[model samples]
Target: MDTRNITYFIAVFEHLHFTRAAELLGISQPTLSQQIRLLEAEVGMPLFDRIGKKVVATEAGRLLHQYGMKMLQAEMDAKNAIKELRSENRGTIRLAVLPSDLDFQLVPLFVDFKTRYPETSLQAFSTIFVREEVLAHKVDLGIGLSGSLDKRLVQVPLGSEPYELFVHSASELAKRQAITLEELTQHALVMYPKGYLGRDLVDNVCREQGFELNTVMEVGSASSLLQLVEAGIGATIQPKELLKQHPEWSHIVSIPIADPAPIRHLELTYYADRFISKAQQQLSESLIEFFKSRGVGEDLELRG
Candidate 1:
């Protein structure tokens, strides 16, 4: 069985579309189909079942996919090992981070990283599904909410920050040092939708307190949420660090949430079995140091 065939099979299995997989692999649809047929012949079984336009993996295909990921990971490990022997620090490090963090929070850290490691390429994707991307091996690392029991992932605590009410400085709420979770219902609020991790955290806390937030608007973009707040559309609850990072938002004031403040715990997550290249390790270290300098997760500790 050629590793190349296994690679093609995995791509097709993931997309469940021949043309889509072919496009991703830089090959023609016929060439991809021929490769899959060759792989099926070599394995003595059909890997995918075609039901009309739907492509579903057969039992054999599922089994192959399980081990095929490991085989490819091993190949990557071997290449990384050889590259390490040559002391090469140049490679692409793909990472996924929450959109909220990417926009205003972690810009300085990324800038510093690129300045220090000009030879290495950094690709940062802003997404809400950080853990899913990391688990699927679509990204080398992820920065998002912690608390995963998946043994396949290694999560390092980044820090925890409390959710604060962000409002225009002229708002009455801004005059106070803090506000209770229940008090949020009294004011019109702009927030992320229910399914988003940040919104879910706040919703869960509200449910625990036996009340729901009076959200007047639901916006997906963090920056948009802030703009709405600035426009006096409504107040918003977000991590305290967001306001601290954006000093130019002088009109925006953040007041701490009291009566059981909601805190977002973040972690640096990556696949446990995947080999960590030197470049990846450096970036991870830089992230930890950056958080420490900002006094986030004050009791932070490095954990596997």
Candidate 2:
């Protein structure tokens, strides 16, 4: 029932290896094992079952893990609340963003936030699984494409933008103001790999329309994908906001997609019960304002 022991247990459960967990925790393997054993004895049940070299959590272990995370989160929230009472702008905010042009686009907003709260430590990284990261309490907040409803999360609608065909100014398609989804299939295209959220959004729409794009290249890096378009290699389908953010990429023109344009809905998500520090609250407001300034989420309702 010791919080320290519960911490050790969670570490071991996450890594599923004593030596690895011990190394991460900066403790010896024997010491970590002893802590786990003590925890198991205190709980009066086997927490893990060892099968050869593999370690698997038992039914009890899984149940403890579910509540253990909340307990630790609550403890941390209490500490953060106390700290905020002393100084409103002195805490760390961990944010996860979609691994695409959106990350680069938000750089200016991040810079402004840092300037306003110099004492606040902001750690932002790009990930494809923004929803999962936020749900697991791995990050204080996340910004990504709208996902399925989860009661544990507070999702604020950032805005929705239409997917447009991006091509080099010199490309033949650039002369057209808009292109139909069916016509887009006739041209060579470069896109994100299969599992990416943005790519999947467009793909799903294509499937619904009874067609698939003629993608000639699949590049995971957002910069590289745009570079391919700049090189006149192939067209790409992306949110129009992406090109609007990069004035340096003036050579690239985003033409609207007609006949039911694919739209990407963006949302800022965080745990509903998690304490929102002043720094986190301000940053969230900044994000909402930033998107509004860009003329993206005008019609979307603000929800938390």
Give me the candidate number with maximum TM-score: 2
* RMSD vs true structure, all candidates: 1.8, 1.4
Provide the lDDT at 102 for model 1: 93
TM-score between model 1 and native: 0.93
| Candidate 2, 215-291: lDDT as tens digits | 89999987888999999899999888888778999899989999688998899999999899988998888988988
Give per-residue CA lDDT, model 1, range 1-304, as digits (tens). 8789999999999999999999999999999999999999988999999999999999999999989988887888788778878865677899999998999878888889999999888999999899999877789999999875678888888888899999999998889978998988899999999899999999999999899997899999989999999999999999988988888788899998986988999999999988888789999999888888888856765555
Per-residue lDDT for 199 in model 2?
89
Indicate the TM-score of model 2.
0.96
- TM per model? 0.93, 0.96
Candidate 1, residue 43: how far the Cα is off, in Å: 3.1
Per lDDT, the best of the predicted structures is 1
